[model samples]
Target chain A: MVVDIAPMIVLGMVILTSLAFDFTNGFHDTANAMATSIATGALKPKAAVSLSAILNLVGAFLSVEVALTVTNSVIKIQDSTGAPNPALTADGGSALLLIVLSGLIGAILWNLLTWLLGLPSSSSHALFGGLIGATIAGLGFSAVKWVGTGAKLDGVVGKVILPALLSPVIASLVAMTGTWLIYRITKTVAEKFRNDGFRWGQIGSASLISLAHGMNDAQKTMGIITLALIASGQWHDLTAVPLWVKGACAMAIAMGTYIGGWRIIRTLGKGLVEIDSPQGLAADSASAATIIVSSHLGFALSTTHVATGSIIGTGLGRKGASVRWGVALRMLVAWLITLPSAALVAALTWGIGHLVGGLAGAFVVFAILLVAAGYMLWHSRKNPVGHHNVTDEWEASPEGLAPELPKEVVR
Target chain B: MSQILLALQAAGQVLLAAVILGAGLPAMFSLGMRALAYGNGGSAEVEVEAQPHVLGKVLAYICFGVVIIAVMLGISWIVGTGMGYKLSFEHFLPVFRKK
Candidate 1:
C-alpha cells in the first residue's frame, strides 16, 4: 500500500492560512468597535485596544454555536450537516484542500491590501468572496450559492448582498435618531457633566461591540479551520470544533486586536467624521443594537457596514456636523468592489494552484500570499499610523486617506 | 423577489429593535444625566439658579437602572444564542428556550 502525504501537507497550509486570515480579521475590525471611543478620547488609544482585545478573547470562548456549516451561505462545498462532499474526499482530500487553501490566501491578501489603503472593507465579505471565487474556479459557477429557495435567508444574494445594502441604511436611521435624541435631551446640561457622562456611555457601548465582535468573527475562522480538518480526515466530529482550534483562534484574534489596525482606525475615527463623545456613544450603541438584533433575526450583516453607517448617521443627526462626502464616497466604492475584487484574486490564485498541482501548488500559493502581505506591510510603514497618531486631527490632502504627518515628526 | 422580500422583512425587524434599544437606551441615559444635573444644581447645569433636588437624583438612578438592565439583557441574549438557546419575550419578560 502506498501512502500519499499531499493532502496532509495541503491541510497544514490551510490551517496556517486560516489563522493568518483570522489575525488580519481581528486587527482589521478593531476599528469598528473602538474607533469612535478612540476618536472621542473616551479611552486612550492603547487602553482602548487592550480593553477590546481582552473582551474579544472572552467573547471568542463564549461561542458554543455549531458554525461548521458557515460556508453554506456562499458556496456548496459542504452539506447542511457541515461535512465535506464525499466526491471531493478522494485522493486524501487534496481536491478540497486546494480549494480551501486558495480561498484563504485570497482572503488574507485582500485583507492586507485593504489595511494598507486604510479602508474598512468587510472582512466577512472578503472571506466569502474568496471562497466563492475559489469554488467557481475549482467546481464551476454553479457551485456558488447566489440565491436560496426563499424559505429563509440563505445564499449570496440573501445573506451577503441584501444585508450589505440594507444594514447600513437601518443602522444609519437608528443612529441618527439616537444622536438627535441624545443632543436634545442633554441640551441644558453643563458641558463638563455632559461630556463626562457620554464618555462613560461611549465606553460601555463600545465594550459591547467588542465582545460581540469576538463571538461573531472568531467563529468564522474556527469554522474554516474545522472544515479543513475534516477535509483532511484528521477530525471526525462535524458539530464541535477541536479545543485547540478554539484556543488558537481566540488568541490569534485577541493578539490582532491588541496590535490594532491603526490605519483603518484612523480612517474610521478621524477621516469619516468629526466625532464627539455624545456622537461616539450614539454610534456605538446603534452598531451594537443593529448587529445583535439582526443576528438574532438570522439576518447576518457585516459589522463594518453597520459601524460605518452609524458614524455617518451621527454626522447627519448633529445640527452643524457634516460627513466628508469624499471619504464616504471612497468607502462606498470599497464596499461595492470588495466582493468582486477578492473573488478575482481568489479565482486567479486557484488557477495558479491548480496548474502546479498537489503539495507544490499549495506551497506556491502560500508563498505568494506571504510576499503580497509583506509588500503591503512595507508600504504601510512609509506612513505609519500607530497608537501614537491614530487620533490625530483629520486633514484632507491630495493623498487620499493619508493623515497629515505629526507636527513633531515634520518639525 | 422572495429573497428581497425576506431580507426586507428581516431588515424591518432589525430596524424596529434597533430604534427601541439603540436610540431608546442612549436617550434614557441622556435623560439620566439631565436628571442628575438637575439634582446636583450648582455647576451641573448651564442655569445658575437651578437648585439641587433629592427627587431628581432618584429619577436619574431609575433611568440609569433601566439602561443598565437593557444592556444586561443584550449581553444575555448574545450568550444565550451561543449556547443554542433563544431569548424570547413570551409574556413581556425575556425567557430562554431551546433554539
Candidate 2:
C-alpha cells in the first residue's frame, strides 16, 4: 500500500496555520501583561515586551490544563457510531483537518484585524469561535457540544461562553476593590513616594501576569495542534502532547510576544484610562490573581478582558480619575462581536476550502491567508505605533492620535 | 442552572484570593512605604528614599517580607503544578504533592 501524500500535505498545512495563529496570539495579547507596566514606566516599552516574552516562555512550561481543555473540548474528530473502517476513517480525518485549518485561518485573520484597529479583543474567543464555526460547517452542528454534563466542562457554553460573559465583570470588581483599597490605605502617603514605590511594586505584579499569560495562552495553541495530530492518526493512542509540540508552541508565542503589538499596547495602556503608577500596580496585581486562579481551575479566561476591565476599574476606584466610557462601550461592542465575526470568517474560509477540492484547496486557502496577512502588515505602516509613541497621551479622534502621544510631544 | 452558581462560586474564590493576595500585596507595599515615612523620614512631603530610622526601617522590611512570601507562594503554585505537584495552602504550612 502506497502512503498517501495528500494527508501529509494537509497535516503540514495544519501545523503551519496553527503556528501562525499562535504567533498572532503572542503579539495580540502581549498588552494584557505588559501594557500598564509600559504606560506607568515600570519598564521601558521594548524592555516590557522582552521581559513579558521571556516570562511567557517560562510560563508556557508551567501549565497544560488550558491546552487539554481546548483540544478535547470543542470538536469530535472520530466516528462515534462504530470503530473506524478505512473509508470512514479517511473521511473523518480529512474533514477534521479542513476544520482545524479553517479555524486557525479565521482566528489569525481576526487577531490581525483587531490588532490593526487597536482593539484588545480576546484571542481565545476568536480561536473558539473559529473552531466551532468550522465544526459546524464540516461535521454539522452536532460536532459541537454546546454544553457538557456534570462538573466536567467540555462544551461551548460551559468552557467558552459563560467565561466570556462573566470574566470581565469579575475581573473589574476584583480590580476596583483592589484599587480602592490601595488608595484608601495609602491616603496619607506622599504623592511622589506613592508613585515611586508603586512603580517598584509593578515589576513583581507585571512579571506574574506575563508568566500567567504564558501559562494560560500557550497551551491553547498546544491543545488545538495536538487535536490535529490525534485526528490524523499520528499519535495512535497517545493521550499527552509530545515534548516537541510544547517547545514549538512556547517558542511561537514567545517570539510573537517579543515582536509586540504596539497599537494595542497604546490603546490598552493609554487609550482606556490615564494610567498612573498606583493604578498600574493595582490593575496588574488584580489581573495576575484572576488569571492564575482561573488557569488553575482550567477556565480559559481572557487576559485581554481582565486587563481592560482592571484598567477601567482603577478609574472607577480612584478619586478624580476619568474613565473614557465611550472607549469602554466600544470595547464591549467589540467583545460581543468577537464570537460572531470570527465564526463568519471561519465559515467563509471553510467554504473556500470546500470549493477548491483536495490538497489544492488547502493550498489555495493558505495562499489567500498569506496575502490577507501581508495586506494588514502593509496597512499598519501608515501611522506606525511602536515603543517610542506607545505611552503617548490618549487623544480621542485627534490628528495623528494626538492624545495618545506622550505629554512632551503632544505639547 | 447549577453551572452558573458553580461558576459564580469559582469567581468568588478568585475574587477573595485577588483581594487578599493580589490587592493585598500592593497595599502592603504602600504600608511599607508609609512605615518608612514613620521612621527617620517623618514627612511624606520630601519623598524618603533613605528611610534612616531603625524601627521604621524594620517595620518596612516586615511589610515587604509578607508580600514577598505571598509572591513566592503564588509562583510555586503555578510552577509546582506543572511538574505534577499540587501546592495547596492549608493550616500553618502548605501541602505540596505529586499528582
Candidate 3:
C-alpha cells in the first residue's frame, strides 16, 4: 500500500505548516516585548500591539542569515549514509512537514496552557523544544547533528543565556548610575518636568525593544520553514526565501501580535515589578541594545528571557521597587519545563505517525490534534480569560489581587 | 498543455486547504476572547467594572481571520501559478497516484 503524492503537493503542505507555526509564534511571543509597556500604562494595549506587529513585518524582510542557522546549523539533514539524500534536501519527503506540524502543536498547547494559568514562559524555547522533541521521535538520536547542535548551544550560551543571566546585573548597575546622575543634574528642575521627560523616554525605549524583538524572534519561524523546505529537498540550498514565505510568516506573526497574549502581559508588566517611568526607560533601552547586538551576531536569544531580566534589573535599581519572587519563581519553572515537555509531545506524535503510513498517517495526526484542540477549547470555556480580565486581577491570590512581594525586599 | 492544467488544479486544491487550516485556530481563539469580553452571567458590579470594547475586539478578530486566509491563499496562488501550477484545495490529499 504505497502512497504516491506529487512533490509539489508536499511542498505546499510544508509551506502551510510553517505559516501555522509562524502565526502561533507571533501570538505567543507578543507578550515578551509589549507586556511591560501595556502593563505600566506607558502604551495602550492596542497601540503597543499594532506597533509590535508592524515592526515584526519589517524585521522579517531584513535578513535570512538566521534562517541558515536553523536549516543547517541545528539538525543533521543528511542521513548517516551521507549520500545525496533528497529527504535531507529542501524538497524531498513529507516527513519534514509532519515534524514541523507536530512540533507546532506541542508548542501551541504549552503556550495556551501557560497563558490560561497566567504564567510567562519563553515561547522561543517552547518552539525549539518542540522541534527537537519531534525530530528525535521522527529520527533517532543519530539524526541530531551534535556538531550543529553544539554550535547552536555555544551561541545560545554565549549570546543568549550568559547575557540573560548578566543583563539584569549590568542593567541594574547602569540604572543605578543613570538615576544618581539624573537626580544630581536635575536637582533644580521641576519634579513634573523630570518625571514627564522620563515617561516619554520610556515610550521611545519600549518601541525600540519591540523592534529588536521583531528582528530576532520572527526570523526563527522563517528559519524553521526554510529548514522544512531544505529537509524535504525542494530547494537545493539556503537560497533566497520566496516572497510568499517571507510575507506569510511576517503577517501570521503580526496578526498574532494584534490578538495579543494578555495573560503573560500581566505577569511581565505588573507581576514582576512595579515599573516607574525611569526604570521602564532604562530597562527597555538595555533590552533593545542587547537583542539588536545579538541579532546582528546571528544568535537567536529568547526575547522573553532578556525582557524579564531587564525588568528585574529595573526593579532592583529603584530603592523602593517591589520585585515579586513567587511569580518570578513560577515563571522560571515554566521556562525549565517548556523545551522537554514540547519535545515529549513531538516524540509521541512522531511515534503515532510511524505506526500509520503516508496520507493516512497525516490524517490520523491531524484528527487527533483537532480532538485535543477541541477538548482544550471546551475546558477553557469553563473558565474564560479575555482582555477585560486578562490582567493581574485574574491572577488575584487569596492575599489580594496584587502580586506577592519578593522574599528579599529591596526597600 | 495538459500537464500545466493538471498542475494548476493541484496547486489550487492545496492552497484552499492550507488557508482553512492555517486560519481556523486563530479564529477560534479570537471568538473565545470575544465571548469572554461580552458574555453575561458575572455580577452586575463586576460586569460594570470590567467592560471591554467588545465590538472593536470582535471586528479585529474577523479582520485578522480574513486577512490571514486571504494572504495565505493569495500567496499560494501567485507562487503556484508563477511557478507554473494552479493552486486549489483539492490537492490537500493526493488525488493522482502513479500507476
Candidate 4:
C-alpha cells in the first residue's frame, strides 16, 4: 500500500506540472500570433486574445498525430517508438517521475521569470533545457541524445540549437522581402485604403498562426503527460494520447491565451517596431508561412523566434522605419540564456530532490516551484502590464533593454 | 557535420517555401489591393482625378481569386495534417496522402 501511494502522489504532481507548463506555453506564445494584430489595432486587445483562444482550442483537437516520442529529441528516456525505457520504470517508475517533475519545475520557473521581465523567451527551449538538466542529474550525461546518428537530424543540436539559429534568419529574410514588395506594389494606393485592406489580411494570417500554435504546441504537453502515465504503468498505449489528457491540455492553453500575456505582446508589437497594418500583414504572413513550411518539412522551429524575426525584418524593409536594436539585442540575449538558465535551475531542483529521496523529495521540489512561482507573480504586480495599458506609446529608457515600465494606475 | 549539412538543407527548403507562400502571397494581396484602388479610382489612389477602369476591376478580382485559393489550400493543409494526411503535389496538383 505504501509503495503504491508513493508512485500515485508523484504521478499526480507530474500531471499538474505538465498542465502548468502548457498554460504558460499558451500565454507565452499568444504574442507570437496576435501581437502584430493587436499592435496595429487590427483586433482590439480583448478581442484578439479571445479569437486566438478559440482558434487554439480548435487547433488542439485537430492534432491526430501522436507526439509521444517528443522526448526522443533531447533525452534518451524513451525508445524510438515512444516507450519508456524499462530500466527507468523500476520501483513503479518513481525514478522517471522525479526527473519529469523537477524538469517541469525548472521550465515553469524560467517561463514565469521571463514573463515577469516582459521578455519573449521560447517555452519549448526552456522545457528542453529543464529536461536536459534534470536528465544529467538523474542519469549520466551519456544518456542525452546530443547529436543524431548517421545522416538524420534527430538530436538536441539538430532539433533545437540549429533551428534556433536558422529559423529566425529565414523568417526575417522572407518578411523583409514581403514588406518591401507590399510597399512597392501599393505605392500608388492611398495610405488609408492600403491600411484598410491589410487589416483584414492581418487578421486572417494571425488566425492561421494561432491555429498552427494550438496544433503544434498542445502536442508537446500531451506527449509529456502521456509519458508520465506510461512511466507509472497506468497507460499502455504508446501511439495515442488519452482523450482526457487532450481535452485538459486544450482547455489549459485556451484559458492561458484568453488571459493573455500583455507584457510580451506590448514588447513584440510596440517595442520591436512601430507596426502598420501592411507590415503587420507581411510579418504575420511570413510567420505563418515559415512555421507551416518548417513543421511540414519536419524541421521544427519556435513560433516566437519566427514571429520576432518577421517583425524586425519588417522594420528593416520599410524605408524610414528603424528597429530598436537595443530591444532586439536584449531579446537575443534572453534567447541565448533561456536554455542554459532553465537547465541550471532544473539541475539544482533534481539535486535537491535526489538528496531528500522518495515522495518527500518530490514534495520538496513542488514546494520550491510553488514558492518561486508565487514570488514571481507578486513581483509582476509591482509593474503590471495589462490590456488597459498594453499598447501605450513606446518610450525609450536610458537604462536600455527594459521597455519603459507601465505607469502606476491610481484607482 | 552531417547533422549540420542536413539542417542547412532543411533550412534552405523552408526558406524557399516561405518566400514563395509567405512573401509571395502577401505581395499578391497587395497587388490585388492596388488593382482594387485602380478600379475604384478617385479617393482610393494618390491621384485626385483618376477614373475607375473596368479592366482594373477584372484584374483585381483575378488577383484576389488566386489569394483566396492559396488561403483555402493552407486551411486544407492544416486540416489534412490534423487527420494524419500529408499534403503533397503531384504534377502541380495538390493531393492528400496518408502519412
Q: Give TM-scores for every candidate, taking all chains together and pairing residue i with residue i.
A: 0.96, 0.92, 0.69, 0.96
Predicted model with the maximum lDDT: 4
Model 3, A332: alpha-carbon shift in Å?
0.7
Ranked by lDDT, the better of candidates 2 and 4 is 4
Candidate 2 residue lDDT tens string, A1-411 = 977778778888999898889899999989998999999888999999999999999988766543343534555554332222243246436777888899888888888888877889899889988887887887688877787678765577777777877788777777788788888877767777778878878988999998988887888788767766776777643446777888999999999999999988988888888888989988998888888888777665789988998898888889899888876876787788787778788988999998997889899889989999999899788778889888877774454542232333113
DockQ of 2: 0.55
lDDT per residue for candidate 4 within A283-324, as digits (tens), equals: 999999999999999998899999999999999999999999
The predictions' CA RMSDs to the true structure, in order, are 3.6, 4.5, 17.5, 3.4
Scored against the true structure, residue A254 in model 3 reaches a CA lDDT of 81
Relative to the true structure, candidate 1 reaches a TM of 0.96
RMSD after Cα superposition, model 4: 3.4
Docking class of 4: high
Better of 1 and 2 by TM-score: 1
lDDT of 1 at A208: 97
CA deviation > 4 Å runs, candidate 3: A1-3, A6-13, A64-66, A78-91, A145-192, A381-386, A389-411, B1-99
**lDDT per residue as tens, model 1, B43-92:** 99999789999999999999999999999988998998888898899888
Per-residue lDDT of model 1, residues A1-411, tens digit only: 978877887888889899999999999999999999999899999999999999999999888895999999889999999999888888878888888888888888888877887889999999999999999999999999999884899899999999999999999999999999999999999988889989988999999999999999999999999988998789999879999999999999999999999989999999989998999999999999999888778899999999999999999999999999887877887798888888889999999999998888888999999898888888787778889878777774435446333344223
Poorly placed runs, candidate 2 (over 4 Å)? A64-69, A78-92, A152-154, A396-399, A402-411, B40-52, B88-91
Kindly report which residue pairs in candidate 2 clash with one another: A392-A404, A392-A405, A392-A406, A393-A403, A393-A404, A393-A405, A394-A403, A395-A403, A395-A404
Worst 10 residues of 2 chain A by lDDT: A402-411
Q: What share of the true interface contacts does each candidate keep?
A: 0.90, 0.55, 0.00, 0.89
